[model samples]
Target chain A: MARFNLGITDVRKITGALTEKGYPDFAGYALMSLKLSLEKIISNHGFKESGAMVSRIYSDDNFTDSLIDELSVETTEMFRDPSMWRLLRERIFPGIFGTGDKIKFWLPGSVSSEDLVSLIILLKESDLTTRSAIILTSLSGKSLDNIASGVFRSSKMEVSEANYTKFQGKGELSEYMVKEGGKFFWNKNLFSEVTFSLGKSHLEASATCVNCIIFRDKMIYMNLTLSNKMLDVICRSLSGGGYFIIGSGESLTHTLFDKHFSQVDQNEKIYQKIR
Target chain B: MYKAIIIGGSAGSFQVVTRILSSLHKDFPLPVLLSLHRLKHIRSGFVEALSLKSSIPVKEPGDKDHIRPGIAYLAPSNYHMLIELGSRFALSTAAPVNHSRPSIDLSFFSAAQAYREKLIGIILSGANRDGAQGLERVASLGGKTIVQDPDECQVPVMPKESLKLTGVDHILNSSQIIEFLKKINRNALD
Candidate 1:
């Protein structure tokens, strides 16, 4: 019900640009981007008194980068949703790891590398680390490298420990990290089995059918069309009977891929790929 | 010596924080910590812009940075910011709470552990019930708790939910928040 004060031409022009840029849901994205740009421009220019200028700048792309950056929520944590990990360990992994002939685990859109690391820890605890190959792919090359480096903020140890306890983790979370001058550094040995790569979701690439594919919390940013397309890609990337996991808040109910993937653990957001 | 003040906001929050920061004096004594729901892909120029708009210094919190008075620290775009008792600020790449990273709950819970009775927790405009449990934790630990007036907030779910969960010390609008902060500071100074 929010009314945009922008002219029709401005709206059309912005919409066209976003559409041409391969954004499937142009209108919603444009509206959100415009709102964020308006706020940033008004505040930065100290033009609080100039409402007209604020409206005019809303549709402009000059502040697009900054606005998008501010609006994007890249918050993720290690072993987040420990229950999901618990389900993966106790229920999912026992079946998958039992086959254990060089299992491949993939995490698409792996931001900051926490979830991927969490998977690695779970794999290690399950005695599947030596036999598994972990692949972490993200658009941000920097984040990929950071994951490969295996460094983490020391302050996270407490919650990570709590999460470990919640999952009934056998070993100490502290055993995986070392304190270095107030910073908690993750053990590099964990990464000895992980492969970090930079890749976009829409790109044409090939990944062998893996044991599991964890794409938690990435689909909410995309529109239904893009989400469907991504889901198609995910289904193709996942091997037969492999696992696919997503954020509990996100649903694939409307997507065509839903029928192809059967829910293994609904509350834990885990699904198994079927024909 | 002033302790930290933790503020949480989500949907419809940009304006709320702006108003609160605009109302406060530049010399506000306590170290202010903020956790706003934001995407990880975005480059946060939020602190710089907010610092320019307000009288106080604003910066995205760095790992182990000491919490200094008169400066405002924001949880980084993708990380949760926490306060340690020795006036140190810690940042973490922890999992999302209530489906949000840089969660108000994470910061508030960490501050409760670090500052205990000295903490002042505030829940402002947001779409979800993220800060409700965190505020309860604060109150249980004898920390001061405040919720933005649900009637006045751009998004009232957070404050309203917090109210439902526990008894808050105050429910005020952005305009009155400055006065409340000043009153608390005066009591500490006294």
Candidate 2:
């Protein structure tokens, strides 16, 4: 509990400073997440005081970018919530495969490459990779670059492997990775046709008529107002009868966009646009 | 006026929690926030089980859901539930703390910041130290803090850890805790 030492006021000061510096308005970001992430950024970057951090944020462009990069939530793991992945592999992917001229998937808010990698592996296993166009977007170029390079933390490999097993993958997850300098580098060929988009918010991300969008757990960080705004964009991006998936525990029931999508699987939080 | 009651419990604490919730009047004025360790994948059954004897509504609050009085909000499995400013619930999928995702410490810390002295935090029987630091935070924020008496606890580790952390306002058994809750509800009525 003491670990999250920053108060709500500190969170406001940090977010407010960033907003005044021409960053996206984070007033709608969940306050507790902002507080915890700010506490981490402040401590990790060795900013002795919020005043010093504010001053630095005002004067330094590179530091501001780095700060924003640090703040982009990267909580996703490969094949997270295996049951959802199983459903995607066993049902959703097969149904959508060969549907479009090129099955387009737009995965937004990927601060880490695990979710994208997982999707690519699934597509490859389903023999749909060649006919697919994947557009991955993120708030930070650094995250996009990391995804492009295929470099990931070696530490997460074990968990990813376990999730893969539970996801009922055809083969070992390690078959697709190589270890170098204590880091796991994924097969870059898998992402050869992938397009990466960097944007500050959903409105700036370029994707239209996408057949599938896997945006899990990201909305938990946003307040209702921001969520509603983002949901409008996400809902519009998907074509009629397209699939949408979110974190197992997340719900769109309270949002205005709920009416546009009907539930596909309640446990997996999978939905299909009803049009 | 007390705005909410936050309770943290883990192993061996379920029955005690059921007792407390079952005993509460349907018109209990404070929202009860419960953070309990549960199997991450088994999502549907816990809320139903708790709701079985609970006189008031028991819900697993969605992210950004409004915090209303007279309902018990159980922290959803695999997500960290928080009390954000403006009396709304916030959920996080950030890494777990003390190996629990709906982390007891995170919930208590956030609720303490959100409600301050108007909050009541209770630590119940459990097998771990997850709620100890949180109970300390509650006390630090000027909120009333209580821990189930260790001797009466099924596991005793959770309550014992709280006793080690801070000078809690009360150390009560299950029945006494229920009485304390009734008294507070009655006082709010007056």
Candidate 3:
């Protein structure tokens, strides 16, 4: 697990390897970061040769999915960014789901299931699991499966529990989870109404109107044209008066984002789709 | 050949950063990326505060904003700022590294990959060891590395830790750091 330096030649080789393997679109993205991250994965997984690694990634869908999984950011926990989570729990959630109305949620780029589980924890508190449905989707199918299976490291649970406590939840965070060996799993029974899908684009790509689109932090990879394109789709897909939350640092300057969604919570990057 | 400068600091590094930035020539032709740990909340105008003493404009770049010479870009709060080899920047909400959101290591490593020997990395005063290892990476990649001399730092922990590890190109104090940058800017003219 020694850190290695990559030259421009290595970047070109890896970018070409990825593009050659059917993901030609990733070349313009953070290819070097992905390259180095993949190198770390390759070393940890005992794939000594990157050429052989690329071949394995092409030959096995599971390997590719796992690679995608490794590349995703998993630094999430229950009620992260305490103030924002508290706002969602106190103000946003009750306002959106009062009176037991049917509500729909779409979480794009739902990385490593932490954010999804956190939201489910909030839903459980409000007693909205039965009346609400959440579409947890990512470009990689494995992320959706990970959400469905709910496998995560046991050590991570304590950190998440602390965050939940910080948010002042009604009960212990682990009360909703089932632990096995070194990992913890969420009880599927508690969130049976939630559905998992590999959503290719934003919620706009889907046929259904989403009441809340939590596309947070996913726009960081997209350029302006792509961001606006997805924003257009988000505006089209979001139900009137629905919420759209981007990353804390991610308010695109595109005029359309301003025109289509009004900033409801600037610090939290929460926007309300205009009626 | 250096096209950009990357500065990483935390805790008490702001004053040193503003000082160095303020002393740079207004027409300095290198994009400077400032990676300082910041509060995730407080969405408005950290860049504006830094720009008050700066000769050149300071901006907090959006996710895909392109880097331009003569401008200083502050890493936005709660995100990891990464360079894309070209003049453009990309950001990530990836988990914090070194217990920091704008982890100095993330940017230093990424900039090393993109700019290699053509980048200058500066580590300033901080309470934590976030930027120390990243400076090693920058130096290893042939990029020039500078650490603020520990004695003159507001908080010496960061620079002292970095000095313990790497034989960086320069170890400078606050005023010396400004003089060093001024020298680099002058060298660019020649």
Candidate 4:
């Protein structure tokens, strides 16, 4: 196990410094440390202390652009979890399609285009595309640019195939991508109906309410308080009878939202807006 | 003969399982057990998917199911499946270990206590060091320990981490893993 050795006093000092610098919670510290560690920005003092220092810096409005640039996971793929996609197609879309109202889908932490593409495919297959609009948002501007360009390494195709199969898929996983000049180009049709945006979770919630919101795998890095607050924002943005899908491994067990949403499918982590 | 073989994996695992099972002849002996880390709330039809690519019978394990040869048993979603002494399988709703339920460590640890030397433990592609400690218990009890070659693994962290923590007997790829199992079965039959 990867252990972090920090004394109580150390935790207090770090927490105090972070509060003084205005970081919302310990997650800013963890995220900052992970970024710096990956970038080899700090060493010798161990990751915990570095995390504290990063948290302190992050809370300051004057934190450097280079520092922010270090804290991103740029590699995300489409049809990442095909079972979830299939679940959305079979269980969730019919309701939205039946409404016949213009639908909006929010995909936060959409690092690359793969997830957006997956959503598009699901909507298309469900015949919900004509009535739906997608908002693909990510914390990193660079990731947004990469998605807009729609270029990716060919090697990722093999892994994507394996992931697709793991989800009990029915279609040929390869039908979604094309190989071009040693790089695999994602199906262009998927993105034609989507809009990509650059944004962060810490910012105020958007005015455009959505029928479904997906923030998968992103909250595992956040602390409880921040995660709950963010969940609140998500709940606020969701229209009544909307849906929220979290990462499969994540839970709202202790949160106020725990009973507010009914589980659509436990394994896919899809939830329906119940209350 | 060993009644069951349990395998565990995390990150970069799907390919490893594919390779291991694909190499088996249709009539290979013994039931195979597996516990893999998947998205917590999502149902992964792993058995159905893997069955399409392998000759052996594959299905998610059920409570009190008999451990039969020539079948592959997968731990179901959100549950830890263990092997009982009398060729029966047990399921538990235990809390998550190392932040994961259906944990590789929990299944291997339980199997180590129950099956002892009769168990075969295989650790495959994953990012974390979950199975390293439990594999130690498996080895100490005379159980066979096989780790996928870190070099060949799509995600080498788990295998490499195990190498650092314990003394394992074999490090091979997916194809070689099948061959090793066949050899073990052949020797046991003799």
On lDDT, the leading prediction is 2
**Candidate scoring better on DockQ of 3 and 4:** 3
lDDT of 3 at A93: 83
Judged by DockQ cut-offs, the docking class of candidate 2 is medium
True contacts kept of 3: 0.53
lDDT (Cα, tens digit) per residue for candidate 4, span A119-198? 76666655667788888776556667777777765645765677667655557667767888877777777677678775
Candidate 2 backbone collisions, by pair: none
**Model 1 backbone overlap count:** 10
Candidates sorted on DockQ, descending = 2, 3, 1, 4
Candidate 1 all-Cα RMSD = 16.9
Q: In model 1, where do residues sit more than 4 Å from their true spots?
A: A1-72, A200-202, B1-190
- Give the fraction of reference interface contacts each candidate recovers: 0.08, 0.61, 0.53, 0.00
lDDT of 1 by residue, A43-104 (tens): 56555333444343356544433333333345555676777888887887778767647888
**Candidate 3 residue lDDT tens string, A43-114:** 678765666766776688777766666766545555656667788888888888875679988876676676
lDDT of 4 by residue, B1-190 (tens): 6656778898889877876687776777777888888764455567778888887888776444567888887777666555544565555433356766577876776577568888889999998877887687678778889899988888899898888877898888877887888886787667
By summed lDDT, the worst window of 10 consecutive residues in model 1 chain A runs over A1-10
- Measured by TM-score, the strongest candidate is 2
Computed on alpha carbons, the lDDT of every model, listed in order, comes to 0.69, 0.85, 0.76, 0.67
Taking all chains together, each candidate's TM-score versus the true structure is 0.53, 0.91, 0.81, 0.54
Tell me the tens digit of each residue's lDDT in model 3 across B1-190: 6889999998888888888888899999899999998875445678889999999899988766678999999998767888876667778766687778788888888888788899999999999988887888888889998999888888988888778778889988889878877887898899
Better of 1 and 4 by lDDT: 1
DockQ of each: 0.05, 0.53, 0.44, 0.04
Would candidate 3 be rated incorrect, acceptable, medium or high by CAPRI criteria? acceptable
